[model samples]
Target: MKNIILATTALVATAGVAAADVSISGYARFGATYSDNADDWNTASRLRLQFDVSTETDGGIVFGARQRFQTEENLSTGGATDPNNSNGARFYMSTNGFTLAMGNILGVIEAAPNLYLPTASSGMGLEGNGFYSLAANTSSNGGRFAWTAYDSAGAGAVEGVEVLYSMNGFGAHIHSTEYSYGVGANYTFSGYTVAVAYEEWDAAAPGGQVDGDSILFASIGGTIGAFDVALAYASTEFSGVEADKWSLKGGYDFGTGLTVYGFVASEDVVDESYGIGASYDLGGGVSLEGGITQTDEALDDTIVSLGAFFSF
Candidate 1:
């Protein structure tokens, strides 16, 4: 009975106060991406508009929904075509410190706020270069990526369920599907936080697709005075094989609208990789960003990009 409260009594307490909220926010970016492997530069761009709707009734209960209409070009192939457009949706009900969500649910591992690098694409360059910095989604290291995430590709969203709870300095989340599930929790204090997450899936059999069987992840991060830093590690097992990856990154703000960040990552199956980036604020919902990432594989892969971002 730790989080027990009568809904009827909550309704009686608020008595006739009904309010609703709606907001639209998104960003657009365009620029050029350069890959050493391609030996040329290509146009990179994306436009995303998010709609959020919420309503609160007499009770202390609130219901909400969110959807994003995103049109993004395929930057990896050096082609500027918006073929993987997305219109995913997520609905939720919340009260106290708990929220229950369904439809295009945010996977536990994917929802960790401080897990990814603080950049325009959460990685490097104009389009994230695949968000290769993350630990759970090991595709960057030639491993299978099977974590549940908010489906943002036009291939249609995955129907799933999740629950997120946060109170004080502690938070927890759980996500589930027909074949996969994950749970995670974090605690924060004095500008520092520690988090751990685990997930498992069973999609193996005769002629079946073998995804991630299990994964364990951990991270510690915070802002220390003028510098923000984080270190993360992940171990995964899939198809009877096990591998691990780790990342270390940091950022600094010069108080003059200019911020710089750098990162290094290593995985058991691949060579070491690193990246450096910077962003400058130009005021009025606009900014300039640029970055270069070097990934070590069979041959050295480098991605570089610069662009302007507009938000509304």
Candidate 2:
């Protein structure tokens, strides 16, 4: 991420010193993706720019807002598609260790610590290659599942609110929407961390009618001597049926700007899925990445992708 600092400070009668600034950062990737089903390699690419503006009140409170502009190629279709409703905003205020956020709120389930692998992209390949390691994403492997989360695709966005508090090694969040609610907590000790989250959706919720209902996710991940490792599990329920799944992920940093990571997962009904990947940091906020993934969605179905990722 690159920093573009702006403007300066003001003194108020009520509080200490107040500062204001705006920062810009985002990432981009371009590469090729291949799968057995596609029978051909397809060019894939994405670009994103994010603006973050913030000001501190004289009373020691902080207010911030974030917005993004993004365009991405549709690797599955071998073309680009509209991102629909180019604007979605998240706003919040924080003081001490507590924060109150509204508008495009981050879901507690999605914010839980250790829930994602400690990789450059947090999953396989450049675009995450379906992010099957995410226990909340039960649907990608052919199971019924859904959870509340920030809209990353620029789709209008869920009108929601959330509360977040973090201090020391403990963190917690609560999120609510028109038809869904979620809660999660985490704690870190020594070099290890544990986290858990739960979310439920009413029938009227977007995916509730199909796989919403409720979902519980838990994970434990952190540094392990020479390696970083994590394990995650989730249970989802819909209508009268229930299913569960688990995943184990790990990575090793070689101190030479190169990292290797991978995961294996098992799910009820869906069976098994796995992937392995490596990334080389080239300095100047850029990296080269590649991965190979196997899924149970079909017989011998696999994905191979390579790309260069940039942040600025």
The C-alpha lDDT values of all candidates are 0.75, 0.75
User: Candidate 1 on 66-162: residue-level lDDT in tens?
Assistant: 9877777753422223454655689887889998887889887777756688877777755666455676546432322356667655443456788
The C-alpha TM-scores of every prediction are: 0.88, 0.88
* Candidate 2 local Cα displacement, residue 209, angstroms: 4.3
**Error at 215, model 2, angstroms:** 0.9
Q: Candidate 1's error at 254, in angstroms?
A: 0.9
Backbone clash numbers for all candidates listed:
0, 0
User: Considering only N, C-alpha and C atoms within 3 Å, which residue pairs clash in candidate 2?
Assistant: none
Instruction: Supply candidate 2's per-residue lDDT for 235.
Output: 83
lDDT tens readout by residue for model 2, 104-167: 7778877877667776667788766667777766653232224666665565367788888899
